[model samples]
Target: MTPVFQPGQTVVRREIMRGEPWIAMPQVCVQDDGDLLVTYTPGGTPMVYPETGAFPVGEHPWKLAGSTSWRGHGRLELHWTGVEHSIFLFWDGPQRAFQGWYFNLEDAPRRTPIGFDTLDHELDVWWAADAETYEFKDVVEFEETGPARYPGRMEQIRAEGDRIARLLDAGELWWDKAWADWAPDPSWQARTMPDGWATVPFEAR
Candidate 1:
């Protein structure tokens, strides 16, 4: 598989929460085997906090929370194997180091002119750093929200989760230990989201 992005390429990754954009720069890496990897440090920017309620309202949409400046929280790494399946590794803030892999069962990312986009399936698997244990991370949450959100795809999504779970349990998964030791190049300047990034709506899987 040809890689879609070159290593060290800068790209904007935005997460839309309650119609607001939370953007970050994810550095790209192309593995020897042709899989693509992207990593970024999250929580550096001031995030939007809903003013009135947990859900968004027309009157008071959001307010900026955190420092006015960017602050680094933890590193987030994503390995995309054609988008049908992607593995995410997060920095466990409490543990103060790399946590473990999160298996996101979703549709393959569609390449856009600006960047890639994909909607996440509700189901996910969390593999502990020890690699000896794992658990279903969002089962109840998915059950509650998935039917309303995904409609007919819940069964397929759960099947994908089951397939990944089996692979993980059989020790057939891969984890890049080198990433734990990896850090971004100090020479790279801070990134901001380009204009019109939020205009494109990411389709649900």
Candidate 2:
């Protein structure tokens, strides 16, 4: 059974494949409506990424080689139930200046005993800080490494990008500029992953 999170509660988000976590981030939950989960992590939050020096980023997560702190913008992650992708709203600096939106195309998040797990598709879309201009990100990474990594799902991933592009074009999904004003609670401290975060059981993408 999945546990419900209260506002301001810290939960771990993990990227998993084949029963191992590739990366982990400790995020503070802002809202949970059963269908969607809104979470936040301020800039400088300690996080972990898959450690791959010569190989691609996702190549070695369980190893926890790329331990680093979240930088630049604090992200409000929007994870919709069963959706293939999640959107992130970014704010930078001490004043919490709103940056923009990021469409992270990935596998749908699966609720876990602790938090949630998903796989990054390597393709993403981004809107400028003012929301005036937009562009697709990680296209080359997706094209170069995706086909070989995801097997026959290359087209599926590209199609997901197309789907997100259409949403951006239609101004749907996290397109609201009002979210720019959203800020993390002042009393909240930077969240870090749990001691056994990587040990969290993977539920498959």
Candidate 3:
């Protein structure tokens, strides 16, 4: 069955299974009658993208609340593109570590590689907004286990997260344009170009 999407409505959509293509979990979902009213007004309701597939930006600004690190309170922005992208800065209360989650459009999110003691560590967890699975990455050296497998099962998941973060930071998905200015040296222009060809006159020499 085709999924219906309304501009001002909230719905719960999830894939049938993990790693498999996300399918809309076809359970009856009701709009929060109260939420719809306020959402249309000045303050809008938070929308959840069909977790079955990649979600567009603006789906949820409240997801980082579930993070376990530093009480895990933060916000992630899924830019204009429908990719898992966000910039998160949080405090680790127990460890007293300052951390940041920088998501590049192409690379997995990368933890702050600087500004911390070598003994300090960072663990990043991403709940697939679609699949009911959790992925994690940790930035620390290992002793018993090689750096390749300290987090064990969570290793692959963390690598993927880091890769995606790199892509987002590089602006691979959406490139913003900037302007540059070039001014020619008055004296240099006169010597380089033919006398009549140069538009600006020499101020020196």
- The digit string of per-residue lDDT tens for model 1 on 2-109 reads 336554555544433333433323433333233565645444433322233333322221233233333454445565656465776666455457677778765665
Sorted on lDDT, best first, the list reads 2, 1, 3
In candidate 3, position 118 carries an lDDT of 11
Which 10 consecutive positions of candidate 3 have the poorest summed lDDT? 111-120
lDDT tens digits, residues 34-152, model 3?
21111010111122222333322222223334321111322212222223333332334455343433332121211111100011113444433243444454334223222422234
Against the true structure, candidate 2 reaches a TM-score of 0.84
Q: Write the per-residue lDDT of candidate 2 for residues 1-205, one digit (tens) a residue.
A: 6677889888788877544566678888898877788888877787676443233334643344554777665788888887888888877667767777788988887887778888888799898786575899989978887765677788988898888788768877554466778866887767867777666667754
TM-score of each: 0.68, 0.84, 0.24
- Where model 3 places Cα greater than 4 Å from the true spot, the runs are 13-153, 174-205
Name the 10 consecutive residues with the lowest summed lDDT in model 2: 53-62
Cα-lDDT of candidate 3: 0.26
Q: How does each model score on lDDT?
A: 0.56, 0.76, 0.26
On lDDT, the stronger of 1 and 2 is: 2
